[model samples]
Target: MAATEPAGSRHRNEAGPVGDQVRANLKFFRARQGISTTQLARLLEALGRPILATAITKIESGDRKVDVGDLVALALALRTTPNRMLLPDYGPSRGQADVALTPTVTVFPDLAWAWASGKQQLLAAEIALGHGEESPFEVLEEFRRNALTTAERQHADHTAVRAAEAVLSSIRGILDRIDNPVRYDVEDESRARHPDSAARLGPAPATPEGLRARLRSLIAEIDALIGDDSDG
Candidate 1:
């Protein structure tokens, strides 16, 4: 459970600067929900807190101080979390320590899922390759599929996605060309002897470096997908 702060430390809800952010958040949420002060007051009353419509007006207009319980209650009535009602609007604070504001990183749900799935597929591919059970082309295909899914969901950069799609098409063509190539040829025997050493072997058709390059391209595409949800 979260430890509660002292009452005195709470945002002083008067007109100057103390509770400006909370007031703005409250007004924005209320107006966005099309809930008038009277309706909100009735909703709060239904929640067992009998606040008047005048009090709701004063609270939203930054003319009245809001208690901790009232803040939580108002947030619940607005159908939002308390933290959402308390987010700072990137404005100046009172005479306190100089605090630098940094951009908060947030991950999109679809991209996050694709990232986790890609990692699992990569680990499985590595294990399968070590056991000489699955073709490397099949692993690359899975990587391409994951990248395509993320690209479709990420509406940030269309050009990067198009390039990746073209590259994937080329890779699919190459994969189809050698769909049933012999796995244990004389050349492969020579390459297998130096399996542990990536340097001694020249660039083979299915070198790990080639796979790493594909992974890097996919990651670059994902990086280009950086933006906030509001942009959509």
Candidate 2:
């Protein structure tokens, strides 16, 4: 029998369009960065996973295969992200061309870029291509639900942060007032405009003991907000 290829080796060697794109991008980015193959190899060596300059040249020439680790290393050496290296040129003029994702599957460059950049899912592309029997709306609704949940959580977190920042700003203003009570007449005028604010603000703490008490209360409020955020 002919000698068998090592397990997984054949797959690596036969990496198709995706691999070709990565190789092309590797060369593009390296040239843009004005780095030679020897320099890139040295950078990879410094990263502790050395690839020979000859191997880097072969990878750029599409004669050598790059595994995940090598892909990451090359990205770092080239000062670009792995997704950038994985995607074909997607300029406006080039966007009309289809990028071969596999031997059989090709997608528009923009769709390929979106998928590679994590802005959209491959399932969306499959649905767009009418490759599945499932209702597109139903499949997309599921993704929408997931995306909405993530967006809502992010919004909540941002709101909580803003609230905390406002509270901290109030505390800092209070401290400044304590430091120079006569300098902040604007605050007093505001307090006068909204008399109910004084009840929430409390009388400006006059002494060291009063300031300590105010700081303690503010710290407690911050802790409570943090606890609620963590629970959420």
Candidate 3:
């Protein structure tokens, strides 16, 4: 009990053969990776496990006893099997990282999953590779062209949106200025002729209908940019 736990409480799974078994399994994994305990702990943190380097040292030294869940977490972090962690002698034949590794365009470096990102990037890479045998640089060059085209299309769409917004803004400014035309022209004689001219013209109505028509026109221009040929 004291071997598993530091001092106060007894371990449910005491350290006799159980402790030796865990330690042996850990050693097997360590040998396979040639990874130091410190490095392993850092790798775990990188994999979001958050175990301290000191804690890993303790666990490896047989001073800190790990729970079953901890063992599972460690296995997952190391990208290995639970069976491999438990029975180190029966460990999977080396370099599993090499197995999962593949050439891909790293669009979002933070994203780890294969499916949920930049499908076009994956598709483009696959298409580039599928072409009749080419040199490595030639393959990459194909992907680069496709990537650039995709990026340019995205940029053009974004610019189209901004252009439409600018057009609407211009139309609004024109209509607003026309609605309450500022008579900056100083006309002393005209003021005298029309005594209460400010009161003569009641508040101007909003140009919602006219603005809506302009908005529809602007949308049609945008739709054309997006290639909405179905409306034809």
* Top candidate, metric TM-score: 2
- TM for every model, in the order presented, reads 0.34, 0.53, 0.32
Mind giving the per-residue lDDT tens digits that candidate 1 earns over 1-232? 9999988898843344336657888889988999999999998999887789998898876667777888888889999876556553322222223211112222322223333444224443255347455576776566656654665446323666655654564464346336424532555677677776634543453444554565566667666677444557
Distance (Å) between predicted and true CA of 204, model 1? 29
Output candidate 1 Cα RMSD.
Answer: 18.8
Tens digits of per-residue lDDT for model 3 on 33-67? Answer: 78877888887777767677788878878888877
Instruction: Give candidate 1 regions above 4 Å deviation.
Output: 1-18, 89-232
Q: Where in model 2 is the C-alpha error above 4 Å?
A: 1-13, 94-96, 122-133, 141-232
lDDT of 3 at 183: 24
Write one digit per residue (lDDT tens) for candidate 2, span 152-188. Answer: 5465346445455445545655665555566567666
What shift in Å separates residue 220 of candidate 2 from its native position after superposition?
A: 34
* Residue pairs in candidate 1 whose N, alpha carbon or C atoms collide under 3 angstroms: none
Rank by TM-score, descending?
A: 2, 1, 3
